[model samples]
Every structure is written in C-alpha cells, then in structure tokens.
Target: MHNEGKTKMIPFGDLSREYDDLSIEIDNTVAGLLKSGWFVLGKKVEEFEEVFADFIGKEVFAVGVGSGTEALHLALVASGVTHGDYVITVPNTAVPTVSAISFSGATPLFVDIDPDTYNIDTNKLRELVVIEKKRRGNKLKALIPVHLYGQSADMEPVLAIAREFNLTVIEDACQAHGAEYKGKRVGSFGDYACFSFYPSKNLGAYGDGGMITTKTPEQAHTLKMLRNYGQEKRYYHTIKGFNSRLDELQAAILLTKIKYLDTWNTRRRDIADFYNQNIKNKAITKPVEVSYGKHVFHLYVIRHPERDRLQAYLQNNDVQTVIHYPLSIHLQEAYKDLGYSQGDFPVAEKVAEEILSLPIFPQLRDKEAETVAELINSFS
Candidate 1:
C-alpha cells in the first residue's frame, strides 16, 4: 500500500520546471532583445558576464563560450599549455576533462583518484611531478583538478602542490556550483576556473553555455579576444582563433536564473543531508563532505559493492539512477595510445565499477528523499 504513494517516476535530473520558474523574466528579456534587434555578444551577454563574474568572486571577463568543453579549451590556451606538453589530471571524471587537454594540443597524463574523495589525489600528483621532472625535466606544465559531484577536490593540498612546482592549476569546476572550502568558493582558488552551463549542472543554462573565471587582466583579455576571432578591434585580427562565443539567448536565460542559484543550491544541500541521514545500508558508502568544505551536492553518489545489482534494484522500484561515468578516461577505447591497462590505476577502476549517482536535483519533491531512502534500506 505504501508503494502506491511513490511519485510517478524519479528522473536522474529533471528540468521541466526550469523554464516555468523564470518564464516571466525570460520572456521580458527576449522581447527586449527582439525590440533592440541586437543579438550575439549584445548587452545581455555583457551584463550577465559582469554579474556572473562577481557571483563567483573573481574578476572574470566572462567570455561566453559555446560549451563547457570550449571553456576548458580556451582556459588551457590562455594558461599557455603548449603543444605536446604534459598536463596532469585524474581519470575518474567526465570525458570533457581529457578532451580539453587534447583540444589544446597538450598530452593528458591520466592519474588515479582518492579512494574517498573521488578527486585527483594531490599526494600522488607530487610523485608524478617529481618523477616526470626527473625523467623528462621541464616537459610538464599544468594540473587540472575536477571538483566532481560538487565537492572541492581537496584544493588546499592541490593548491599547495601546484604553487610549489609553479604549475598552472585550471580547475574543472564544471560540476561544482556554489561549492566552497575553508569559507572560500571553488572558482576563486585556482589560476583559472572553468564552468559548464549544461542544463544538468547545479548552475545550468537553458542550453549549452560556459564561462571562465580568472583574476589576471591579461588572461581575461586574451580569453575575450580568443573567443571573438582574436580581434580586439572591428575587422582586425591579431592572431588566428576559432568561433566559440556564447550565444545571447543562453546568456539572457542564465542571467534570469542566476538570481536564485544560491537558494536552489541550499535545497540540493538539504536533500543530500536527508539522504545521508536516512539511507543506511552497510553495503553502501554514502558521499562524505570534508570537515572544511560546503558541498553543493550536484550529484548524491553512493559507492556500492554490488553496484550493478543496486542500480537494477532501484530501477525495479521505479527509482531512477545513473553512473556519472562507467569508464575511466585512460581505459576508454579511444585513448589506447595512453596504453593504460587494467590494474594501472586501481582506485579509478574501482570507482568506475562501484560509484552510482542517485536522483538529487534541487527541485526534488520533499517526499522523494524519504521514499528513496526507504527503498534503499529495503535493497538488501
């Protein structure tokens, strides 16, 4: 009888109400744009950029890039990652992390992740840097630490290590929105911070959009020029560039929703707490936020020994779940030349097999957490 109380279905992440939430402001913004007859790098994009830069607590020039991948690509270029140079990054993350390095003509050196944090292990990074410098001596350049699942990747240690070696740190803060550590936001810590405005991220755009937050005026100015065909003045190009500017429509839509980003992030936090407090299965290991961080809970992923079976169990009960990534980047068929085989990075491989992200969007109904918890409890 209690089973009848469940919602029709629980999507991994739903955005049905997203448009409805800001329809009024969005329609008004669109009408204004239409009346002005100005599109593509207009006032809306300019204003949104300033506001968003301020929001992330950085002096970002906020070049609206076409997508999250482009944000990383542009940031890497701006950071001076040269062709064939090595960039260190963890394997247990979205494919775009590796793709960005490849796009910049830099070779990605895949590293293992922390067993608990699911983030690139900074201590392991020290070893990699030392060995690479000893072996190749001056071939290594930068580090890309992904803040997976809205938790800062233990940035304190990562930052220390990066500074010690004078390597550029470009944070893949794509999944982390409003996440903080030691009372400071994620984007503010690194040399360059990149974000994805894909509709599923914690701070998502209506469609594909992205931004880079940087402190240096030189870096910011170069990023803007890079996005606009490397032209500082009209019809004049200083250097060759690509067409990857963020669209005006996405900017207007994102600006409307930016006002409520904090509240929604708080809601996500509450739902995560609900799950952590309620879901008690000895076979499952819930996500752990370090003592000094404010995790935004973009995904409430749990580690399960019987991960495949647990996913099937949730599906049979009409609850939806997804594997954030079922394969580590180095082990993929496309990266065969990286030559990483099984047992090369045991930690990342283990996470690939066991980690499962549950339904934990901000707009999730109040009862869904309890019900999901109850279902998990009964999962044996």
Candidate 2:
C-alpha cells in the first residue's frame, strides 16, 4: 500500500540513492572502455591499481581479483599456504575469512576475539602460536587479522607475535577502506593486505571486486600470474591457477567511488561520533576504538543487555537494523565439525548474542541519526 516514489519505510542501507549519480559515471566510463575495446587486464585496471596502491602507501603491485574471497584465497596462495597447513584466525568473523582459507587448501585454526574490538585477540593469538609450535611441530605459517567492522585489529601485538613465529600477516581489510592504524593505512601494515569492494563497503564498486597488496615484487608477480591462469605470457602456463580477474567494469566503478572514499568514511566516523555522544541507554555499550587507528565505522555496532527488546522497539519505530553476525563461526553449521563446543570460545559466543548494527551509512542525514539516537534513548 506504500506509494511508488516515497522513501523506503526505513532503509537498512540505502545503496540505491548512491547509484543514481554513480550510474552516469559508470556509463560514461564503460562507453569509453567499449570504444577502446580493451576489456581484460587493461589500462583501467592498471590505473586503478596504481591509485589504490598509492592510497594504501604500498608499492604499485595489487592484483585485481574476482571478489574479496578470491583476493584472500590468492593472498594465502601467494604466501605459500597449502594443504595440511593451518592459518590462524578468529571465528567471530565473516564466512569469507574461513572460506578463503578453505579455498586455499588450508585449515583455518579458529581463535577467539577481544571483547571490545571484536577482532582476533592478539593475546590469544600468542597463546595459540605457542600451542601450535609444541603440538603441530611446525610454525602456523600465517596470521590473517581481519579489520572487522572497519576497525583495525590490535596489530602492534599481532605483528609482534607474527615476527616471533615468522608468520605472514595477511590483513583482511575488506571492510576497512581508508581505515588507518597509527596514521598508516590498514593495507600497508601487514605482509599482504586484502580489500573487498562489495557494494555496501565504505569504498564499493558497482559489483564484486577485490585486490591483493604485497610488499615484495616476487609475491606480486605470483599473484598476477595466479589470477590469470598462471601465465607470464599468453598460452604459456607456468603453474595452475584460477580465473579470478577483476572485470574492467567493476574497476572503473570502484575508481569513481574511490575518489569519494575518504569523504564518505569521514562521514561514517562523524555519525559514529554522534551516536556515541547522544544515545544514553544504560543497556547499550558503544563501540570502543583503539587510539592507534582511525575507525571507518563500516557498521556502528552497539551491544545491549536487552538487545532483543531493543531490536523489537526499533522495528516498531520503522527503523531497520541488523546483527553483523547472528552466529559465531564455531557454531555455524558449516564449521560444526571443527569439534568446537559452545563453551569453547566464550567471548565470541557471548558477543554473538549482544551485538546489534544500527543504520550508520555515510549518506544517512543528521536528523536521521538524531532520530535513531532519540528512539534508542526512548527504549530505556
């Protein structure tokens, strides 16, 4: 019964409004592309890669890939992750984090998260490294610290342990476009940085897109070859690979969006600040950011003691919200066979029930934030 031209009853993240203007840019870019007639592995991708590499302060050697998942898989592969080797990571993360490890023919050794940042607990990671050294009889090989929810993990401790174990740190920076740790970008701090330009991310393409950034020229070359069927030249295969190229269309769309990434991320930070200042619900615990990083606020997740009741209240008020993850990876049907019981990762287990993501997209107006804050305060 809603009219055709009205705003949504309430938008979770109004991705459409952004596309109207962005569509024109994409169309023009595509037309130029069609006229040029070079589609795969062309100048557009190269240009964007250089720009993106510059953005992250790394050497210009990012291999554009199919999706965030593929970028992660390729990074692991480039880092020499193989069958029977285990990649240590947190279970309270996106499925792609674990899925990419599985895709790389490695087992993902699940770890618990820190209660505050929701990132892999660096202290817990150190403990596991010791356990792996003793029981597994070899190094764990790699550490993938996911910058979940647009905040960098505590990389100081994480990196220290990685050095001790000689582990390659592949940062999952998919949600953390323009996010920085100690004035250094997320993609530059780790051994290999992976970014996902999914449409909802802070820096989104029109569709699925991803990239891998490494400090070494050799690793970059390997990624470039691996994504394109393992060839330095056409019809001369060096090693087996996959069809994981980032299409020209996605690259172009991302290029345009990339221009506005910092601005949009700033807006997200502004909204998060607003949320932190205004909402005075005793049941709610706002996100805590470490001083070393500039959090991009991909999803402004808050924890509430009466979370279920708060969700219902928001629903009744025509405000749409969601849980970033309803179930921890350990409890998911996909990972149940890891032999993890409910009591295993108590922090992640408790967190899954408490975290709630409010609508905090950059385009959300000031009044919308004020309304969101007022409604939450009303719950008390």
Q: What is the C-alpha lDDT of each candidate?
A: 0.86, 0.87
Candidate 2 residue-wise lDDT, 310-352, digit = tens:
9888888878999989898888888876778788889998998
On a 0 to 100 scale, what is the lDDT of residue 151 in model 2? Answer: 97
- Residue 133: error of model 2 in Å? 1.6
lDDT tens digits, residue span 125-144, model 1: 88888887676556688889
For model 2, which pairs clash?
A: none
Residue 182 miss distance in model 2 (angstroms)? 1.2
Error of 2 at 211 (Å): 0.8
